[model samples]
Structures are given as C-alpha cells and as structure tokens.
Target: MISFKKQLLLSMIYTFILVLLFQSTALSCTTLIVTPGATIDGSMLVAHSDDNHLIDQRIIYVPAMDHQEGELRPVYCSAAAIDEFPQYASFFYPRINATDRGPGYNTPGFPQSIPLGYIPQVAHTYAYFDGSYGIMNENQLMFGECTDGAKVQLDPKPEKLIFYSSELSRVALERCKTAREAVELMGKLIDEYGYYGTGETLPVADPKEAWVMEMAPSPDETGGLWVAKKVPDGEIFVAANQFRIREIDPDDPDILFSSNLFEIAEKHGWWKAADGHLDWLKTVSLGEYNHPYYSLRRVWRLFSMVAPSREFSPWVEDGFTRDYPFSIQPDQKLSVRDVMMLMRDHYEGTEFDLTKGIAAGPFGNPSRCYGPNDGQGDVGNPNRELLGAWERPISVFYCGYSTICQGKADLPDPIGGILWVGLDKPSETLFIPFFAGVQSLPLSFSQVDTAQFSRDSAWWAFNFVSNWANLNYKAMRADIALMQDKYELKMLELLPVVQKTALEIYQSNPDLAREYLTNYSTQNAEFLVKEWWNFADQLIVRYDDGMFSEPKKMAQQVGYPQEWLDLTDWSQGPITYKKRN
Candidate 1:
C-alpha cells in the first residue's frame, strides 16, 4: 500500500498532467434542485448546465430492458470525457449496447473505455433520456450533475475505481424509482465497490422529492466517500461545482452517508470528528476552482433572486463563508419557467452583471469565456499561480447544453416528467420539452459532430444563433426574445391541452398514450430545429455589418451604445485623419 504522503504526491502529479492535456474539469457547471412543495405546481425540478470543454452535445435515448439473473452490469470509465475522445464512444450511443462507455470518466480520457469493474444486474432496467448524464428514467428519477474539484484528485486507474458522477447517476436512474432510493443505492455501491474521478454534486430528484448528494474520491483503497442531505420539501437547494452538504450527522434522517466517510477524512487529516461533527466542505473539498468567488457568486445570485426579501449580499469573505445557507425557502413558489429563468442568467441587474462591463464589448454580449491563461498572467495579484479568474454567470457562452428535469407528482411517470433540453448557451436557447415516455428523440438531436459544422444537427442551429448574436447582441437579443416568447408561451398553453388528450388516451391503452406523446414531442423538436435554423439565417441578414433590417425595410446602421462608446479606449488612437495624415 502507498503511504499517505505518496497518495498526496501522486494526486498532485496526476492533476498537473490533466491541466496540461485536458482543461480542468473544474471549469464551470451550475446545478440546482427545487423540492415539490417549493414549486408552484408542486413538482420537483433538477436543473444542470453541461458547461464543459468539447462535450458531445447530442441527446440519446435508452429504452428499458429485462436482464438474466446471473448477469453482471459492466462499468467503464467516465462518459464526461466524451468532450474529447469521440473514438472511445459511438455517436449512436447508450441504447444499442450494454457496456457503452460511461461518461463516468471525469478525469483524463482513457485510451479506450475498458471496464474498471462490474456489478450484479437487476431483473429489469427502466428507459432513460441521456445527454452526457442520464437525465430522467421511466419512473421520473432524475439527476443534475456538477463536477467539483477536491484536494484528493485520484487518477481514474484500472484497478482502483471506475464510476464517475455521470455513470453513477446513469446507474441510479436505471435502477431506482425515487431520490431516496438513488441516494441509498449510490451510497451502498460506493461502500461495496468504489468511486473514481473528481468531486461531484448530483441533485437527484423524482416526482416526490429531491436530494443533494456529494461525492469525492477516497485517498485510500476504499474507492470513494459520499454524503447526501435531503432538501426540505419547502425549500430549494443549489450547488455550483462545490459540495453543499455540511455537518455529517448520522442520526439525522435527512442526511445519508457512507460508514467510513469520517474515518477516511480523519485518516487524511481533512477533519477530526473529535473536534465536532465533520464539516464536509471544509474538510473534504478544495473550496472553489479558477477563482475565489467562482462558485459562491453564482450560488449567492440564485438565493437572492429566488427570495429577494432575504437580500442576500453578493459579497462573502471567501468561498467557504457561512453567509449563505445550504437551503432556503423562496419568497414565492416557483414555476418551471421561473426555474429556467434561474438557469438563464448573466447577473443582469446586479452589480456583478456580466453584460454591463467594459469587457462585454460594444454590443453588451455577456459571454466572458476567455480564461486567465489566455493573456499574459495577472502580475499584480498575490495568487500569481492562478493569474486571474472570470466571474462565471449561470448562463455561460461556452455551455454545451443544459437540462431541467421537471417532475410532477400528480400524474404517472410518463406524463409526469419532461426533460426540457436546451442545445446551446441557456441565454441563447429555447428549451424544448422531451417527455419521459419518448422511446426515441428526433434523429437530428443525436447527430452532432462538434469537430465540424453541420446543418444536419439541431445543436448547430442554436450554436449558430448564439455565436452570431455576439456581432450585435443588443439588437439581436430583443429579436431572439420575441421568438422565445412566441414558442415558449404557446407551448405553455399547448401543454395542458396535450396532457388532457394523453390522459384520455392513457385510460384505454398505455401503449397508445406513449405513442401519442412521443409523436407530439418528436414532431415539435423537428419543427423547432428547422425554424431555429431559419431564424439564424434571418439574423445574418438583419444584423449584417452591424446594421438592423427586417422584412420590409432597408438595413439601418445602428451605432454602438453611448455607454460602450464612452468606455472604449480612444486613448489608443481613434486617431483623427487630419492630424495623423
């Protein structure tokens, strides 16, 4: 066995190598959970921003299957690494194969996804909608994932452990029907087998409840350590690539954890239970990555927005500040639209508004994707190693895609759950509802090759619009919102009528109900993707050369905003031709 010193040294060496090859998995991802009672319709919601580097943006469908008693479920390395290793995966994914690569490898890519281990298979596995992570199963079990960096960064080696958060969530979705079942199952698996990859927070939700489960790699041979706390039915929970579960209390029914959780931490000197109950974040985590406020600022913003009466301050002493509560009751009950608004934010009205700064450019586009390493290092800052960091907003320009798992308790699983998928940056996307009943998605949704641009992929259409909007964001934003409202509001009204029809069909035959629901979902996606492509073309003509034009009029040259013009560095010489020539 390696000594403790050797483990720490090996982890650091592995981490340094990862940053040089693959960008840090700690980049950015915001995930949240809204409990049933906190939502206006009394439905649980789990939302995630798949904000990683070069991710496979396609959404794949996996149908339920029966298994033999003696069958063992094969587990591979992380599926999250699909962002880079396309060869390790088939674009035609999860459905066709049993041992398809798990997005579980959140560390560096394996040369090939050879299985780390296997577990006993259940008699029946439910169908699920999967992106990089398993979204929702036929039972309405859902997951929202965020990768958080920890002090112990174990390399996902062959013999030690294999499952990353994506794979763990996928397995949970296939096997469990409720949030409690998932948390318990995941904890049991981690105890018996092992977990690999970086620190991860998964908001697992079902029609009845939602829970925040946080996991980190164990430094010893035990595999992994995990802790989960159920968000109260009357409150909401948010995690932005950091552990939110605190105070390991075994007696608390709301909290669930592994037996060796504290023992592992104590052995590593991360925490000592003798002092008090273990503080999970302070003990097990590296706090935040990239910058100090990188995680907290987003977390604070969500709390402030949901319950403005609390007036949560944007400022905190550091990332570990106790200023923000783990969960909170909102000022008003939220709807699915309200939750989407939470996901699509750039801190617009607040002091930290990304669109208001000089860096936002002349058009007020809030995309600040450039990293500290992009330019010369920030020589002035004390933490010279970091160089600098950007304020990561909820809706980021680099986001591959996002999902809101909307789960309703009043209806059956098929009708109760909708995996609302947005292809690009949340700010630039129109969320399309894909019901749990769908056995297949529109083929266009699964046909993305990020290495090359293609008209065949639905993701590219939104990608095109998002990238193009930067040219004249101010003019184009309003134009985009018009369409957003047109479809979204219409869909909002259309959903109830469709639900009524599906329910009527369900009474006679479940198969027919699924068929009807599937047609409505796939057809809407097909129509929306085509319309969005047309919108992108219209945006090209309307905003060409920084001019604004519509169907009946000639192009109008709308100059830069006065605020932008004033902020511009004319000192570099917007030189007068009379003087210079």
Candidate 2:
C-alpha cells in the first residue's frame, strides 16, 4: 500500500493528467460548414478535424437496425468507449480498463454491454458512418462537432447526465433524416434526458440547408441549455471550439433552443431583462477555453480566405470577440476541391503565419509541439511547458483524421453523399472518398492498435509520411505534394465515371451499387495506402542525411537556408575558423 503523502502526490498528478487528456480531444478541434448556395455544385458540406494526440483514427460503419416496440436504444458512456473503438485507451487510463494504455496495454478486448443508461428507441434506425463522432447517415444528414469551453463541464452521471456530444451526434444520425429534425431531436433529448461534458457546437447539414447548433450544460447541472441558428444560404460557417451563436431571437423559426435557455441564464445571473436578450457566449461559455487566439485565429483565417474583400482583423479580444461574423458569404462559389484546399491552411502569408517565425526552424515547419503551459500563463522558466502557447493553426499536425461530408441534392443518396476522409494531418493527407451507401469500410480504417505502429494501418501510412516530412519539410514537401496530387487528382478525375457507373447500377440493383462502391472505395484506399508506404520509403532514401538523391544524378548536399543561418547567433557556438584574407 502507498503512504498517504505519496498517494496525495499521485492524486494531484492524476488530476493534472486528466485535465490534459480532456483538453487534447475536447478543445483542439476545428469545424467548417458550407451551405448549398455557397458551393459551385450546390452540395452542402460539413468538415471536421479530430485534432487530438493519439485519438482514434479509425472510421466504422454502424448498420441500420430495426428494434421491437419496447426496445430501448443504449446510450453509451461515450467518454468510456475507449475499449470499443480502442482509442479511449490511447488517451491514457480514462476509458475501458481492458485496453488501458497503462500497465494493461496488452489486455484482451472486452465487450461494451453496459451503458450509462438507455433512452426511448425508434423502431427503425438509419445506417451511418462512425468516426470519433457519428458522421453522415443514409439519408444525407451529416454532422461535425467542435467541443468548446463553458462555465460548467460535467462528467456523465448515471441518472442525471447521460449524454455527451459524441453520443448525441450518433443518436441523431441513427434516427433523424433532416437538419431541422436532428437539431430539434437533440435539443429535446438534452432537455429531457440531460447532457454532460464540455460545451459543444455541431455543424449539421443536409441537401436542403445547413445549420450549427450550440449546447452547454446548465449551471445547476439539471439539464442542458441550447440554441441553434441556420447558416444563411450562400454563406460558410466555421466553428473552432467556441460559441459563435450570439443573441437569440427565441421567436425566429431558424433559431431552435432548449426551453430553459433564458431561465437558466437569468437564474444563474448570467442574463438580465435589462441586459437584453441572452448572449450564449457571455452567459454560458468561459470565453476561449485554451489561450487567446487559439480558436478565433482559425475562424478569422477561414473567413478572410474565402471572402478576401470583406477582411476581418486577425486580432480579437478572445473567442468571444464580435469582430468575426458568425458566417460569411464567399466572394466566389467554392467547389469540393476548393473546400478541401481551404481546410489545409496554416495561416500562410498572414502576420499570424505559423511557417515564417524563428520558432519554425530552418525548414519552415508549421507544426507546433504542444506544451502543457500553453493556455496557462507562461512563467519565465527553463522548463519548456512554461514557454507560452504556439499559434494554433487550422491544419494541425496532431490531427488523427479529418473529414469533408458532401451531401448533394441532385443525386441519389447512395451516389450523392460522400465522406471524404483523410488520415493524419490535413496538410499531408490525401482525401479518399467513402460513399454513404457502402456496406463496409476498408479494414485498414478501423483495424489498428494505436499503441504500436503497423504498416497495415492506413493511418500509419499517411502518418509515417507526415512525421517524416517534419525533419526537412521545406524540401521533402515537394515529393509529398507530388504523391498527394498524383493519387488525389486521379481519384477526382475518376469520380465522374464512378458516380455515373454507380448511379446506373443503383437504378437497377441497390445492393450491387453498394458492392461496387465498396469495392471501388476499398480498392482505392488499399492501393493508395500501399503506394504511400513506398512513398515514405522513397522520402527516406531521397532525403537521406540531408542530401537530395535521384536515379543517375549524383547525390547533392542540402544545407540550411541563408536567412535561417543569418538569424543564428554565431558567437553562442564554438569559435569558427575563417581563412585570413
């Protein structure tokens, strides 16, 4: 047994670890929503990044099921689902004990039979794609979530709080078909069953329209308070772990909310009649969760890039600043590819650009290694954690996976809805299409054990290439870009044919269409993933020991940039001998 003093020290360390782990998945995500009118092809799009260290990079298919009249839908302890997906264990010890990445790292898998509780079930549930959160469903209803900061963060309690944003999203996909239907159902469930976990903003979209719904737990933790506003057609919305919905009309049809939204605010002294309508951020959110500019910079950069003419100042007070609009209309209509390009941003060419500083080193790498004292005030110390926060860019290197959900009104659901998935970092990943109608996903997407590296994992394939490029990013990136474009462009070129063939087959036999899509999707994923491993190997051989090598051509030495070398303090190093002139 441990001594009391030692136990106390261990307790403190455990608490600190818990906070870090929560912030990793909860506060680091970024979201994007594009309405049909804003896109070139009139496709509603929702994109999300599961930006966390050691997050579950896999994507699975949750099949449609029909239940008995009295059958209840199990509400999973999503916070405790690490064993089922095997990702929760990767975050440390907060999840399924069997797969705990701790001392029990190699423990056998255990079934997730017990749930936090159960909710009223629907007779018929829809088939959908599942990732870190429930993704798109068979009906083209899709969602993307960003967990933000709030006044109260609660763990899922047995009877009081049973739902998290992840479960809410999965349930919505399991039952709903329209954007309005999903928002209304989630708000009702939160009010009746209660909600837990950090504040969240989910970008919900269908072929017809797109909307963002924001939710936060009530001060008393009695239930959840919420509000949602539809993204006006012709506009694009971005959610970066902060509440962007402001004053609620309460009367507008587009704005939906929990009944107690105003009452809870007033009761908690977060709102007043004389103070005017309720402000979601002022009343519920704790401003920016992490550090200043962590969330806002991402929002500002995305908006400014799409609508360059309507520029917004990058400098904002915090996540609550009104400088950035809730959504903006792009000057030009965007394509699916254009949206993909936008998500790969690093705040380049702006003052806040992550690649230009001395901190980026000689290779101009934009990836910032996260330190513990990032959000907390940095005390001047030799410890690296106290060195202050880095600029959190839209394209994060730590991202487990990122997705773009495209729901088209013109085509059938099978051919129309596509989940464009990219493993690892958005900057380096080649987006692969996964059709909503596919019966199964490629085994590589969900078969990995994150505790160790496996060549069979598609995530590892992209992850290997990305982590390798960090060493000589400025040089090796050219080859990475070539590999990415070679396959990605090829896929884009074949998309028309695949859709046309799939649609024709879908008209006659829906099952065959699904099989065809599954084969195509699986083949593309497997083929590219295989090639990617070779790509990684080539990068090592070509850039070996900081030299650029090629067939026939002699190996050429690569050195540091003149600008980086000039910035160095020569006197800090041993004296260098120079030829006397």
Candidate 3:
C-alpha cells in the first residue's frame, strides 16, 4: 500500500536522522540560543550547559595597566557585565597569579586578562563581554581568533591612547543615562583610545538594543593599527572570525560607525581615489587575499540565507579577498529568528562543509585538521586546516554551559528565561530552561568532567538520543519529531503554570521563586530524559522494520524532501540563475 515516493522520502528522512544521532555523540558541537524578557531574575545573565570541566564557573581575565606615574598596576574585573543598572559587576573568575619553583613554566605575576579587549584596563574596569564558551558578547562585539596557535594573550601597547579601557566601558553604567548616551560615550572613547580590537565586529550591546562595530587595520602596522565603525540599526549583523562592516553611510548615524574610515584611508594613501572618492573596500583588500576563507564566507552564508536573492559563493575564488570590509549591512531589517538562525548555522550548503556529499573531497573541509591519530577519521587539507582538540567545529558548548547573571546581589530569584536551540542537532538535545535564581543545578548537569562517555551530563543526553537515531535514521527522525512536538506542547502547557507560580512567589516570598525554578529544572530534566529514551526506543523498534511496507509510515512525507525539512536554513534557497560554465 506504500507509494515509492513516500518510501523514498521516509528513507531520506531516516538517513538525515541517523546522521544527527551519529554526529551528536561523535563530537562536541552545541548551539547556545537566547531570548530576552523582563523578569524578577534581574537583567543580563549568561545561562547554558557545557562539556568542559570549567562549566558554570565564573571567568575573569585582567591585564596590567601602566599608570601616568610610570608604575604597572593590577586591577580586578568581571569576565562579563551582568546588569546595566545600579551597579556593574560580572560573574568572572578573578585572575590569579600562579608561580612555580621549577624553571620550566611559572605563572606570571598576573593572571591572563581574559585577553580580548581594545582597551586593556577595560578588561578589569567594565565587564568585557564574555560569550560564556565561544563568543563573549552577543551583540557581535568579540575578540580571540581561531588560529592553530597556543591561546593568545595581549599585553599593553607603548602608546596609551585613552584610558578608553574595557574598564572605561563600565562608564556606561555610571554616566550614560540612556542607550543614546551609551553610544555617544563609546564613540568618544574609541576616538580617544584608537579602538584597538582584533575582532571581526565591534562591541555594541546593552540589555535593550545592541550594535556591531567592525574595524580594519591600518596598512602601516601590518594589519595592526586599526579603526572601527558601528553597524546600523534595524539591520541584523554577525561577524565570525572575519571583518564584516561594509559600505559608508554618511547620512545615517544609526547605520554606520567608522573612525575616520574614509578620511584616514585617503589621508594615509591606503585607498586609491575613485571618481574623486576613496574606494574603501578596494583599499582594505589590497594586500589581504584570503577574504573568503578568512571572513566573507560567513557573511555570504548568513546573508544568502536571510536574503537568498543575493549571489555569493562560499568556495569560489572571486576577486574579493581579506580586508574586504568591516561590516556588511543588508538592505532589510533582520528579525529575531533570522539572527538566531544565523548564529547557529554552519557551512552546510557551502563547499566548506566537511560533510558535504558533493565536492567535499575536492574542495576539502575547513572544519577539519590532520590529527595525531589518523585513525580518528578523515584529515583536513593541509592548505587550510582548523585547529582541533579543545575547539569545537561550531562551539555550541558555550550556549548551554554558562549561567547568565547580572550581579551576585542582583541574581534573578528564578532565572527561567534560558533558551537553548540545538541548531546543528537540536532534535536530539532537550533545551531545559535553568534560572540564575535557582540555588543548585541538577547533579547530572554538573557531572561533566573528562570527554569520555557519560549520561549524567547535557552533552551525554544529546549523545544518547543522537547515537540511537544514527543507527536508524528514518524511523528515528519521525520519532524525534513526534517527541519534539510533545515536548513543545508540554513547554507551552507548563509556561503558564511556571509564570503563575513565579508571580505568586514574588508576591508572597521572593526567595521561593528560585526554589520553584530549581524544582522545575530538575523535574523537567528527568521527564525529558524519559521522553528521549522512550522515543529513542520507539525508533529502535521501527528502524528494525527497515523495509518500507507500512502505509502509515509512507503517508508521513508531505511532498517535501525529508533531509531539507529539519535543517536550520541560513540560506534563502537555491540560486535561480544557472551557473555559466
């Protein structure tokens, strides 16, 4: 009774599901999804789960500041900012100096300044944004590049510009009465300090509105001397490992941020005059030829998804190269979903995808490397290899491993607004909402230690479901979808109860909110585990049926490709124009 088309669809779906299950356990790739709303749990918290031993722990990195008195001083600072009100404190591990008697290696007089700031003192002064695991700041203000070297640690520069340190950024909490004030303050600080950051985008985020500031290095400094400009409002932008700011909007302050972007390029002779105007993009990319691999590919991938009409190739070597642009503001207003999808995406459709069935071997996987043990799997191309071990392909662990809190005193009673969307393999993972207001995380959530197999952690939970689904794809896919549907409905059903309970506690006893959220998380984790196991078992049985004989199974496909349905489509669609060979 089953149609061939239906059977084919089911088969494909099964294959895709199996891939998810296999990959989930094979490595550590997780996506951190966040959503915001006003709640009693306070403002500005980073909440998520992770596989590393450093999970749920606060991180702080401080740098030495040279005082006008010619003395180097140490300052304590938060890894990130928690609340944008009353006080500015972060849940960062204060940097400690470690010293050893052995001459091999001794901790320096100071701990590492979480080492990614345009202004050094700002690392301690203002909470330099920490994206928990991968990205420190969500509004696209980030530092630290993914290179195959020991983690980088920057020290003080000879010419101290402004006290425009990251600590000075804390001034936003002190001086800026409003968001507009904060923007103006940032601009002034950049003007004074020279905006020295080694990130793709600039740091621009408050609790309400966020902006991306992209910078380009000056030609004289071997890509060292730099200036940054802010991204415009109403448009969503993201920068991953490469510069993203593009175009000069002289008319709109909300749409751009360039520190003498035009004047400096022309004044310094870095940019050639074009029709009496300096060509910014051309000048930036003159010496830098690896733009696609270094940066633009991510932009093309993201923009291609939200607006598929644009034509850009992730693999092809176009005239474009590095120093391409600092920002690329699209012509449309980006929605929350668009931003979320962009953040969670990988190089799936592009030639860079290690898993791309087509042209994968030919083009090579940018996400891979030559491993010490070649037996682990395929080794990446030598020309462009990614650093592996301790690094994730997409680094989703940060999304689930850290807790978002504003300040220790202002911690939300029941921080319930945690959102974790397992983009690459979300179906296998259950995004349990945890609140900073809670007293303790479940023992299982905290049980992560070595990278070995264990079901007591969030990583393992994903591993469990994904591993089983991998063995049998089609049946697992349907089962996983069904479970997700039920889980979503249950969440919808429970949200009201949770909200009402939170309100009641807020009125009667404020501290009780944490208890409610804590209990809710523990119970939710247990119940979801049960659901995952049950659904996984159901697939085990159905997948054993292998052959497509059942009519009920055949009817599930609704004329769509099973593989395409579950993807977090960052691209709009297939290009309408045929390739001209």
lDDT of all predictions: 0.78, 0.78, 0.37
lDDT of 1 by residue, 538-557 (tens): 89988888788877886887
1-581 per-residue lDDT for model 2 (tens digits): 88755753564466457545444433468999989999988999999988864445667777777778997776656542221222222232222222211122222443322466678888888888877778899889999888777777676666678777778888899889899999999988898889887788999989988889998777788789889999999999998878889988877888888888888888888888898777888888667756667788888889998999997888876556899888999999998888778888898898878888798889989988755545442111113243467888988987888999999998899889999998988989889998888877777886655656998899889888899998898787777778778888888789889999999999999999989988988898888888988888988888888778888765788888888988996435656576433
Clashes of each: 9, 0, 48
Q: Candidate 2 local accuracy as lDDT? A: 0.78
The sequence of per-residue lDDT tens digits that candidate 3 reaches over residues 1-581 is 98755753564465345334332212121211111232223222222223222222222221111234332233223222111111211222221222210111123322333222233222222212222232222121222221110011122232432222233334443233233455565556545544322222234444444444334433333222223344333333434433343445556555544456566577666654474443334444431112223334544565566445455545545434432233343445443323333443445555555334321222222223323422221111224443432122342322333222222122222333333323123334544444334444455543432224655545455555655655444345456656665675567467657767776786778767756766886678667766665665555555453433234664232232334443534244565576534
TM-score of 3: 0.49
What's the C-alpha lDDT at position 30 in model 2?
91
- The residue ranges of model 3 lying beyond 4 angstroms of the native Cα positions read 1-197, 202-208, 215-234, 248-251, 255-298, 308-418, 421-428, 434-447, 450-453, 463-485, 492-497, 500-581
**Residue-level error in angstroms, candidate 3, position 392:** 13
In terms of lDDT, model 1 sits at 0.78
The TM-scores, one per candidate, come to 0.90, 0.90, 0.49
- By how many angstroms RMSD does model 2 differ from the true structure? 5.4
